[model samples]
Target: MYIPELYKNENAEEIKSFIKTNSFGILVNQTQGKLWGTHIPLELETNLQGKEVLFGHISKENPQGESFTDNNEVLSIFNGPHSYISSSWYDHENVPTWNYIAVHVYGKIRIIEGEELLFAMKKLVDKYEATSKNPVKIENLSAETMRQINGITAFEIEITDIQAVHKLSQNRDDKNHNTIISELEERKDNNSQAIADAMKKQRS
Candidate 1:
């Protein structure tokens, strides 16, 4: 994550909040001279020391879970909306670019099992289902279903480092930035709309 000083976001709380909103991320690691990656939705938690820890799980059948041994170093990437910024939107001559939000978390992995895995599952379900009209509850799950869910290999990572970038055309002048936002807002795509919103928030 080569974030320039101009685009770097140093706010720790903001970065954590971004990860919570975009909980689905790619977990990357290496083993046996090969690279492996798995897409998983993670839950964030804090230790008694107030340090951030990440919780997530992968199928026991997934070789990535087996690779979690040895306290291997792992990287999780959380990506937000992004869109192309056409040079045509700029007042003067310039090359095209992109605007987006991303966070990289590096940590040491440890596998968790038994009641801890069940607890993680309940937390995840409650978080995502909170906004639904018919929210799901852990008690609603049958014993067999809960056992099946527990079969997955849950893991926790005590995050050692974090890097975040919010590249929302901050390098451009006010006029150019506003122009890009306007054009993006007019576009029907969700990514463009999201970029526009992020740019507007940055401006504020």
Candidate 2:
């Protein structure tokens, strides 16, 4: 999250969009004697304060969830598109560099169970299926199915701070930047290709 001025992303809407696209992030928390991290998908929401909030769940047996208490702070990292920009791409004799985008959200978690968890489940089902031709509504599901799904531990992170970095050769000369992007566009890797597209969009 230590983003240099050249790499910092100050666009609030872009940061939110990054989180939406890369919602599957590592949730890190420190407790008692150890620190733990779990990679899971999350639903983003706006809190009453109009701040980013993360809602996710874990298995009841996952001790990682119980650590979120009165004292623990949490951090979730959302890594977007990335690529390696070889020094060869640059016209000068500079070291190789990496071009990437990443966002980190810091907050405190409030663990929810029972009814709150149930509501979260219903919301998620609606979120994904609402746009489908045949929507699968959680509310209409059988009680047994609902019970099975809501048995896990659910939680929400009230995001207090966010840091984003988009190092897309912004500091480089136009020629070098174009060279790196052109190479990425020709690659087979979708991630790199996507990065190239995003960089091109930013440039325009």
What lDDT is reached at residue 117 by model 1?
A: 66
Candidate 2: where is the Cα deviation over 4 Å?
47-52, 130-134
RMSD of 2: 2.1
Give per-model TM-scores. Answer: 0.93, 0.90
Worst 10-residue lDDT window for candidate 2 reads: 44-53
Q: Which candidate leads the pack in TM-score?
A: 1
Clashing pairs in 2: none
TM-score of 2: 0.90
Q: Find the candidate with the highest lDDT and give its number.
A: 1
Q: Please, what is the whole-model Cα lDDT of each candidate in the order they appear?
A: 0.87, 0.81
Instruction: Give candidate 2's whole-model lDDT.
Output: 0.81
